[model samples]
Target: MATKTRVPQTIDAYLAGVPDPAAKKTLTALRAQLKKLLPKATESISYQMPTFKVDGSAVAGFAFFKHHCGYYPFSGSVVPALAAELDGYVTSKSGVTFPPDQPLPAKLVKKLVQTRLAEIGTRAKKLAAAKKTLITERITDAAVKEATGHDWKAWMRVLDKAGAAGLPHKQLVTLVGRDVESGWWRQSIAVAYEQARGKRVVGETATTGFQVGVVRTLPMTAPQLWTWLTTQPERWLGPGATLNAEVGGSYVAPRRRGNPGVRGEIRVVKPGKRLRMTWQPDGWTKPATLQLTVMPKAKGASLHVHMEKLPDADVREAMRERWSKVLAQAF
Candidate 1:
């Protein structure tokens, strides 16, 4: 008669009790992979399986059965993204199974771990954004008055008298900045004024819009990069390009030969760190926002471009390619 084995209470004990040598080896390799991928995660035995957790949430788990090993991502969506790569394996909504004799490939395991980590990161970002929204929504008239020395009604009247209803989004925000001293109060007032006047405010996405962004590390300091962006854009853009270098200022890149020039209004200007503007090419139906952020690294600086509210997919891709070319030339 065969001896009945007791279920182990800890991850180490569980791995030690696996009777089949091949299964034990496979499990050990997987354990090592998980540990390598998630050095900060906690490992434990949960539900008679080995589980890895981060921030007290389960990110991944695994178990060995008689003939197969199972990989659990703790997410129903994670496996579906890699469906093509998992063609030969058995999969369900939350996990995948591979034969013990044929251990999961190292690359596939790495991809699985990465996907789980990304999912966790995305979830955390959403939660933080939601919390920020909640806090913003809780701001009251008293709070605005205390911060900016003016109540919501007073700010509304000021905006109404200033003809904010007729102004564009960028101009309205600039106007708000000038009227309210505190940055937080300024944003709150602008939102309230827009809501009262039926004007669209920030954080609302257009129905037919997309966003594209790219990052590049340049061999220069952030201040030097800022100078390049502001003073010498014509080197990469083209001759005759001009920038005003202040909020609410206009910029123009003159047409050369047969090409049409670009025009925009600077909406934000933070020295050596960030710049944001509204971009409209000669034939574009609507304007889009372009933001540049610079961060100092160990040796140089990293520049990032984020363009949003593009009208269509084609325009977005075209803009991406154009920016890629521009960066290639600039660097």
Candidate 2:
């Protein structure tokens, strides 16, 4: 009769059960270094191997196989991204195989782990975005019919008849405008059509250059955040700021120096929910739209910063960094 083997419930058990001295020593050192680099990560046994997960996402893992050891980034794209630095090592789309006797260098291990972590972070953000409400959700089928005398399917049919799929953004908008009266509704319908046909992506519009948004979750309620934002405007808006918390009210955000002050009007104010406004700082070409919103979450709440009409990708990145800093430092 054949004997059954017990599986390891922990990484330490897995390491101890490795019969090969070289493979055990190599895996032990690699595990120690991974723990050091990923102090915040949760270590667990996944797929019968020692794995390190960060924020519920599997980043890096390792396993001992016959004749060699394997390092897994758990992402197909990670290995390809660093293919140039992986010379002399046996690599696949998912993992890298190294000789057990001559364990991977500390530098190489660091690169592999860091690259996997970065890829995981980017994937997490994209997944979060995918889970958010879509345009169709915001503009419901019934609401569309009530507002424009047609449902989404009907509007799509109308646009399709106009050859909107092959038309440029402006021309498509013009076509929609022949029926839709309001400029805002025309732009919205055109964008919705473009998104449905896979022509335009989220946070992108021909007229608005580029749009970017960032969200930060804080351990507080929406009302609490609203108080902080309305009272402590200097933290985010700028220093010596005067913000009127009402629709059609004008406001000013005076910077210290070098960076000029912003002057704008509050376009929409839904207490503890959303605040939309237009801002044009000193020496700016045109005003940019700024929207701040608060959403309730399980633990606390989320603060949202949405900026539109950015001049280019550079400005988009700059505003992203600026808002990230504000979210991190403020509240």
Candidate 1 local distance difference test against the native:
0.74
Off by over 4 Å in 1: 1-5, 135-331
lDDT of 2 by residue, 51-107 (tens): 888777677788886678888776656788888899888876667888889998999
Best by lDDT: 2
TM-score of 2: 0.44
| TM-score of predicted structure 1 | 0.42
Estimate, for each residue in 172-290, the C-alpha lDDT of model 1 and write its tens digit: 77898885667765666766666566454233442324777767788999889999998886755566678887998888977643245789999999988999999898888678889
The alpha-carbon lDDT assigned to residue 299 of candidate 2 equals 88
Q: After superposition, how far is residue 223 of candidate 1 from its true place, in Å?
A: 76
lDDT values, one for every candidate: 0.74, 0.79
Question: TM per model?
Answer: 0.42, 0.44
What is the RMSD, in Å, between candidate 2 and the native fold over all Cα? 18.8
